[model samples]
Target: MADSLRRIDSGEASDDYLRGGGTGAVWRPPPAKRGALLQEALVRRPGSCIRRLAQGDRARQMQFSRFLHNGAVTVTEMAETAAARTAVVVAGRDVLAIQDSSELVFGGKEARARGFGPIGRGGNLGGLLLHSVLAVDAVTGALFGLVDVKVHNRRGGKVAARRARSTADKESQRWLDGMFSASRVLHEAARITVVADRESDIYEEFARRPANVHLLTRIAQDRRIEAAVDGSTMLFAFSDRLPEQARFVVTIPAAPGRRERAAELALRYSTVAVRKPKNGAAPDLPNSIVLTLVDVTETSVPEQGEPIHWRLITTHTVDSPAKARMMLDFYRRRWIIEDYFRTLKTAGFDIEAAEIQDPDAMVRLVAAVAVTGVTVLQLVRARDGTTDQLLRDAFDPADQPLLETISATLEGKTQRQKNPHPKGTLAYAAWVIARLGAWDGYYGKPGPKVMRIGLQEFHSIKYGFQLGLRDV
Candidate 1:
């Protein structure tokens, strides 16, 4: 075996990381130079990861599949790369590990996609499930990287039919598992705030917080609340009695199924002592836990539009209006992971469409592509450039020249064409990318479609530039 293929510790760094480092973790060293080649092949052709392999000669394509199914390149090691990238990004920053689960449905009807558990209380398709813990800067609201990912097949046959299973044995336990894994990995961050959707409103999870770890989650259960000034109350009842703290505006980004809208929302929050489950399902739960509840209700919107109503629970001290708004923003950042999942599916990487049939190989394939998906989404969201992050943070040195060329071509003539955002800012790279994606370069701001298209085009340009350089 080559020196590069040495089986170092699980948490080692990759060799080709000088390019501002994507999610390139040194999952155990490969048996040969295969590790480096695998990363490069994925980086070069991510949108159609499996297709890229097929496009090659027959012998080589088999090599690709063989590599994916290799004994050494397990999903656990691939996740190590995501963890490594995340640790670097959130080293000293106050960040949120936005946690969520997404399922990939491979075949249409009952194909029984290998190695996948039952999803959605028993649904149509079969495929693997992933729960991701992605780290994002809380202050700038920028996505740093994925801190951790847990991939498993659901077991919902007669196994799920067994009614005696504890909640710990259920799938929802993935939420708690994701939180603990993320917290343990990102404990060094200045602040590790776990943000989740309403599904994570687990009382036991709230009670299990580690030091310096906080949670800002939407309240799923309208559980019981301790007494107010006069009498006992339930969750929403406690929320209804609170005085309005303030009102604010938030930008709701567009998704595949939803349109973008700005919402003027009303805010009301109060502290509550949450009583334990009276039924006593959870024996380990505390008798009562005190937490701040923040309600952000839509003040006004067109009747045809969906109204915004968010009942959030947080460990943060929400005494002042400013603090309350801060927590809401943290909760909203949860969308970052949602966008990553979008990239993993049809919106971008399209990993589910891979032609591989082997279950283990598909899992390994999805793991690598998951990191690539994050890289693409990161470029799309790295607009603020508040951190003045270098273009090198995302673009390679060789690729920068091509990016500058496109940037110059896009910024034709007038001041509008000239992106005023300084170099090294994400906005600067984003402007160039949006233009490459075929934006008019005059639109106010590019939407996800434009960013997604532009990223694909930019990857092509990078590939071409590399080929040209190699030909020299």
Candidate 2:
């Protein structure tokens, strides 16, 4: 067993390592390179290992490299691809999915070349937009992975002279194309449900999505739908069947490029049925479910607000009032994606400031970064009690010394000082892990305001210690 461990740790393992050499024989090697062996073991462990493993996927790397060199692919396509892959690997089929887009503004100069629209009044301080998909474990509220990312154009009003006659740039089409492609990928994985805001209710988006995949999307005030019982045409509106305590509020993040605030609402039971348009082809939609529309407004700081009334359309079935309420609860999970985007840009990956010139390279890099974030979260969640036996089981026995070093460092820190924020308490270990994963975000004095201790950081610290163990 020791010999096989040595061979694997040294990158010298061969097919013969698995072959039986002798009966009741236990191959052992002299104790040496213990630190190096431990470091290798730490790298091999799952849950924060994606960042390193990403360097080894030749096919994915090659595809990204080609796209980067060509400058033809858009960030949205890459994000969509990453989201689709994540959905398959992490969320599978039984999860309720939330998808949304947020704007980030790079500088006007960066936007000019990237074809991003100009910053509207009060938008992010010159940043690009990012749209992302978040999957929450239905029972645990744990973040699974990012399904997609869309970087909006910063120069929306500018038009190049050569393409002045065109309606839109080819880059814009990539968002739609990527969405279509991601939908296919989701369909291939499992029977899953999707929830989105009204922006996703466009004809192409709904029409192109796979039939089996369920969607719950907010409706525009101008959207037309018919009453299932009355057969009368009208704009979709929330039914008056909500609980008296329903409320709504908006949220605005202090991050750059997000000048606008988002609305969050809490509503009660309402009926929704498809109303076919008078002149257009009827949408191929399944049975509709009535739901209470809750619009949580965007705000920089949490505050109180009035509940705004709205309506939504969904493909899910809400046969009972309780089921209808549950659907609304599911929709609230959409905020998880927003939190994820903030974490990626401000805390974990910092995708916006990345200098990779090739769009493909940017995509590959973002994918790797996003996956690394998820991996860190997974590792932090896996730790049990003070020992973290799960990590020990996955790591090679030779890597113990490095792990002990990390444990000692953490042991010295006060529990109150680990995660000062109330929301980040569950993710205190994430901060340490991020350090192990090679995250450099918290290097400066006192860390940034947006920098909360998180799982990614924990993964980094833990992995770094493991690497040290392997080298010892």
Candidate 3:
């Protein structure tokens, strides 16, 4: 199936079946076949628009247009495909299902006509809200893939109060929904830890966690909890009273107006019984839920910027300092999803810039782009040999020969020109692709953009290789 698609993409075979008449009207194959082809095309070339993806081929571009607009192309099916791929790599491994949300804002006079709700500025702009679950190896922080994605548009209106609506009706439901989706997708994993930000701190989310899954979230609300010393007290106040366990230094990355510096942070953690909110109580839920709260606060004042403070709540055991540090490490994986969003948006794919206009089609395209972004990330991580991953982790077993062929051709007589990583490792493949993208082997590592371009060229070569096999 993939070979046939590759032949068509390489222009070695005619796309007559993809066109209706001599004039080149759009025609599609069976729904399943068409979907498969569309998925292949998107993965072959990651770009902002269908025209560029089609590379000026009228038939291919029209085919993508039809596929996106087709009612059968549902987000659920796309998400399931991504989940299945992730499940393969994450099986028997402790996985971190990091979840986060981002806004895709489209700016233009016709942006409002694109059928999306207002995003930025005074309910006047247009865009869609996206929430995604990125699966990562808990031990190595190596990205696996996206397990779930939910894209929605907010309706323009006078929004009701948060308490007025049931949890089902509120947009915050995405957090809980994303967690369950991750659990269902990664059921074979040894352990599944769902990590997220403060927005995911919900009573029902903690109360309804499955036996195999655990939740780790940055504390958002200062809810009432049963104090270790005595009666109920606010979460923040209770945490403030706990004695500091130890101090650790972490390098704070450079940000706007903040030079990178090592921050000495004091850590405190203890188990507490969190009282459920009285206002939005469900009938079957318990009055309180037990959770370990870990408070991480920077002890020293920095020359610039605010001090670091994080109150984290989790279901994982944090009795000892090592366990507490492990929980903190898990929370750090949230940055992986943030980096993914950056790749999907401004930094790499720039999906918002795509010319796709319809809301439904836009949602489907965003989901596809979300999946494609994983490939770039895998290569970026593999650019350095520390990941200890195999080529099969990112590329198919069949592509090994082509990767080897490309790697051999890229090597020069000099030692520096040769691939430094071991053969058959993902790093070796990355080195070959980086060379294809014009990156000097001796210079800095290949980033996402370099890897993305290299991947595009690799797929193009793969298509030609597939055509050559047909002749042989």
- Candidate closest to the true structure, highest lDDT: 3
Deviating ranges (above 4 Å) for candidate 3? 1-32, 228-230, 255-259
| Residue 66 alpha-carbon offset, candidate 1, angstroms | 1.0
Q: Per-residue lDDT tens digits of candidate 2, residues 126-220? A: 54445555554554455545555555544445456633422124343433443554465455445556777666664344444566566667766
lDDT (10s digit) by residue, model 3, range 1-472: 1223323222333332221110111222233344545655655677778888877889777877876786655666566656666777778999899999998988744777767888876757789899989888898877777788888877777867878777888888899898898889889999999999999999999998988899999999999998656777899998998999988998876655889898898999999999989887676889999999999999989999789899999999888988998888899778878778887877678898988878888887887677667777777766878767787677766677888899999999999989899988888988988888789888777777787778788889988987898999
Pick the winner on TM-score between candidates 1 and 3. 3
Residue 66, model 1, lDDT: 66
Query: TM-score, each model?
Result: 0.86, 0.56, 0.89
Q: Flag clash pairs in model 1.
A: 25-81, 117-154
* Residue 336 displacement in candidate 1 (angstroms): 1.8
Give the alpha carbon lDDT tens digit for every residue of 42-148 in model 1: 55455545556445657556656666777666666656655766676567889898999898877744447464555554466678888888878888767767777
The lDDT for every candidate, in the order shown, is: 0.71, 0.43, 0.78
Which candidate number maximizes TM-score?
3
